[model samples]
Target: EGDFVIMGTDGLFDNLGEDAIAARILQAYNMMRIDGKVARAVCSWASQALLNDAFNTSLSKTAITPFSIAASEELDLAYSGGKMDDISVLVGMVEHQVQA
Candidate 1:
């Protein structure tokens, strides 16, 4: 129930896997819960976290990324490490109003 709505470009997914992305958002979710704040309050922090992670991963020579794996098997090419590209990430939350 605390998960956020994440949207991004190919660069984001290319550098990071599902588990890496989930951990970042979950950290923000947990922090917001502890602070007793709305999910929206941590949106900025979560987005930044994803950006930093993706950027780091993209630059890591030893880090295996989704794009690398696909390029290796599907494309039958010799590819290693993360792929550098234009990454954009957005973190948001949905709020609902219950009837009285």
Candidate 2:
């Protein structure tokens, strides 16, 4: 399967949903494409953004994301209400194969 993959820990998903994460990654990827650069820096930035979003979601008092709900229900009460954990994200871009 030659496809781009984004592998992340539960902490990453606990705060942000798939749609949000996809949008962020697409934003980062587009930015890098416009800059004519594709490197680890972009990936790192994306990961940091995810972490920040997660942390902020945890702090927000107004609304709770579905991810947070699921996450809380699955874990201890201490982490029941919000997303407060170690976030980790990894993005892998697949290059087109060269035909022989």
Candidate 3:
């Protein structure tokens, strides 16, 4: 399978960590496999999963998110959960061209 890339704004990171992001992408990939969707479709499904997770996490008051942990560790702040923000997610894979 070809490799895929995931890109997002700070808002995305503010709620989800690398582990969470990877999990969502993996879920989407597996789902595509079951649905008969090509690998390229994985990116589209993954992006939606990521966006939904981040947006939901941002609204939580008790969730320990990446940003909250960073704030506590780096700034000694008492942040406990993700802040509501404008989340953006992009997922894609490079396609190879074959010459006849």
User: Each model's C-alpha lDDT?
Assistant: 0.88, 0.69, 0.86
Candidate 1 C-alpha lDDT tens digits along 1-100: 5447999999899999999999988888888878876776689899999998999899988788998999899989878888889999999977676799
Candidate 2 lDDT score at position 42: 73
What is the TM-score of each predicted model, taking all chains together?
0.87, 0.69, 0.87
Range of the 10 consecutive residues with the lowest summed lDDT in candidate 3: 32-41
Tens-place lDDT per residue, model 2, 36-61, is 66656677777778777777776665
**Candidate 2 colliding pairs:** none
Lowest summed lDDT window (length 10), candidate 2: 76-85
Error of 3 at 82 (Å): 0.8
Better of 2 and 3 by lDDT: 3
Better of 1 and 2 by lDDT: 1
Candidates 2 and 3, the one with greater TM-score: 3
Off by over 4 Å in 3: none
- The top-ranked prediction according to lDDT is 1
Better of 1 and 2 by TM-score: 1
lDDT of 1: 0.88
- Candidate 1 stretches with Cα past 4 Å from truth are 1-3, 98-100
